[model samples]
Target: MKERFRLWSRAQDASPPRIAAAKAPRAAAISSASRRPALPRGVRIYAVGDIHGCVDALDALLIRIANDVKSSPIRNWRIVTLGDYLDRGPSSREVVERLIKLNELNCLIALKGNHDVWLDTFIANPETFREWEPWGASATLVSYGLDLVSLGAPDRCAALAAEFARVLPREHADFLRNLRNHYVCGDYLFVHAGLRPRVALRDQKEADLIGIRQDFLRHNGAFEKFVIHGHTPVEAPDVHKHRINIDTGAYATNRLTCLVLEGAARRFLFSDTPLPD
Candidate 1:
């Protein structure tokens, strides 16, 4: 199984097209075979990396997961999303709605990623809007639901901005306001980005969790229980000896990855599937 997984991951890394094809079939298979049993218990921590506005993908993944747990013999099911829940791709609005709904229904812990920090900054300081490229000012518009192009006149920018503010949903703002930075399961710490090897999980800054890539992944994580994260979409889930990365770059590509760690046996069940668009 290990060898087969390695081969699959490597084939995915072989090319961007290959990665998509690889992920799509693997996910499709899981959906077809997964039977709906009762929701499993016992702390099976299922983690997703970065979902950039892929609502359909997320929906499909969740349904399959539901089917999987129902068929399994367990007591509980828990999900940890590594952030990047908003921006890019399509359906940012729907994505937030679904996540909030998930939290309401089950045991879910959503962490903040760099994209989320950008979203926060966009909300707090709309002036910083011009800084980013295509995605710049996106969150501001999303929060307000006003088309920047439709502003039409320079004079309306401020008025449009205020209108946008008024239209903003209170709960939507509250959700972003309340998003947590990290999550821990058993011996492992799940972060959006990563932590400095020397720094304790509690000591890591908010910025560190949303951003920070290489210095963390490149280093021999050697942390306790392994740092499971999303943020940097890996070829597959980077199931190394120390860390696991399940972000399959859903926004850019069409694939979403999930890391399913069986609660009882402590074994890993990797399932990748398409977002139900």
Candidate 2:
């Protein structure tokens, strides 16, 4: 028997082929060639979590932000998504596209999650980013409309994979061009994953930056700046003063969350919106 696989979507959501009827976009999504994000006075930073391809929820997250934010003299704000932008949901392609659009509009700092590194490494390693083995780690292929169930039979899957091979998003490829590893501030270090436990920052490796979680979480380690991150999905935004894990696994739950802060104040904003499987 051939290796059997099921697509993540159901009939109501539209099959991969029918979804393929509307291929993923490859447009040059970078809007304004702006260099850096503006850090204006009284600015608020909306640090977001793992989107997991739920564009609708992301839109709602921002919409809630707009409605809730009171009008003021200086409304300079930043939208920082904590990586894992692709995979595990129905709209990974759409999420990336929207992020590109959002980046063009405001100050956006998209960090690199472990999944991102996996995808990027796959893309960079041509042997891994091909028809026989296109990108499909933890539901990326499904999110990109290439899951076997959606693509049909084995032969049909191969053909569709070949076609997807042709239409990979240039914008997404560009989006992964130079993703930042980690960010540091006065009180904390913002990372996609987390830091190694009981280790000094100077001794941490890039892999440790986006790969170590259990060790960091289980072990008792101290840091100069509290680490704020996403990737570990808990019931809530995992706010514990020292390290806050904000990845609420947005793709499946549809209940995406965010972490908001103004200089010293730390608060969280979340949106509960159901999405297509």
Candidate 3:
């Protein structure tokens, strides 16, 4: 498993595509009358983008964030990882292990992504691998010591999924299973994907929360709160008046983004050293 994980490490180092500058309107300084949401006084939130099995990037980003915290201390700090922690890259096992470790160290809020839901669905019915494989699930299986060709028969697929259940660590399984759909901190709403337009946060559908793309992505109206999400990969942290997307395609681009929020201030931190303005 270790050797197989190493083989794909180089793939994780490739630079991400440069997105045409984010088309969103430039955010201006917040004033007392500003409509934008704000975090609770004294609370600092670091919302990370979709990881997609890039353990190396994730580790680097975490260290960067820890260093940032050390430089400027805050009383309350939270780490919110928008999911897709599996698939696409190498070391899905390592990513989950690191997340488990992070949870022990900080106030961690892990949200479920569509890929994670697919994994749970596959665990319930291995036949879904037919659907999951093409969407990068094969990489996750490979990390767990399963070969794609080995699941040729439906029965074999089911058997392999059972074996996966037995082999996957209980801590990781629980971490995935117990992930939240969304978390509300002060005035910001953290979700794995964009929410359905006009739907109240509490009334949002599960599909929209973790899977909806275009409809949620294109909406320009205000949501119940400022929606901080991942799922739809943007070239950079696309900040708009209505939403903020920070996925940055970590698995393919090797740049994991983190959105930092304190009071009404917003900034970005990536896997690399240069911080966003």
The most accurate candidate by TM-score is: 3
What tens digits encode model 1's per-residue C-alpha lDDT throughout 1-277? Answer: 1221231332233322222454432221111113321113466777776778776666656655665576574565677888888777666777777777667665678887776655445445555455542552454355347666676423344455465567767776677777888776665678888877787766778887778888888886366446778878765556555666778877666677777776323333333442233
Candidate 3's C-alpha runs over 4 A off are: 1-33, 149-155, 274-277
The TM-scores of all predictions, comma-separated, are: 0.76, 0.71, 0.85
| lDDT score for residue 254 of model 2 | 71
What lDDT does the true structure give each of the candidates? 0.62, 0.62, 0.79
Estimate, for each residue in 1-277, the C-alpha lDDT of model 2 and write its tens digit.
Answer: 0011011123114321211111111222212123212233486777888887777677667655554454322356667777887766677777777777666664578787766755555544434444323333435655566656555534454455464556677777778666777776555577888888767887888787876778877754456567778878765666553667888766656767777766666666666532224
Where is the poorest 10-residue window by lDDT in model 1? 29-38
Q: Which candidate model has the greater TM-score, 2 or 3?
A: 3
Task: Give the runs in model 2 whose Cα sits over 4 Å from its true position.
Answer: 1-41, 70-73, 124-139, 142-162, 273-277
Better of 1 and 3 by lDDT: 3
Give lDDT: candidate 3, residue 259: 92
Give the lowest summed-lDDT range of ten residues in model 2.
1-10
Sorted by TM-score (best first), the order is 3, 1, 2
Model 1 Cα shift for residue 14 (angstroms): 32
Candidate 1 regions exceeding 4 Å error are: 1-20, 23-41, 136-144, 152-161, 264-277
Ranking, lDDT, top scorer first: 3, 1, 2
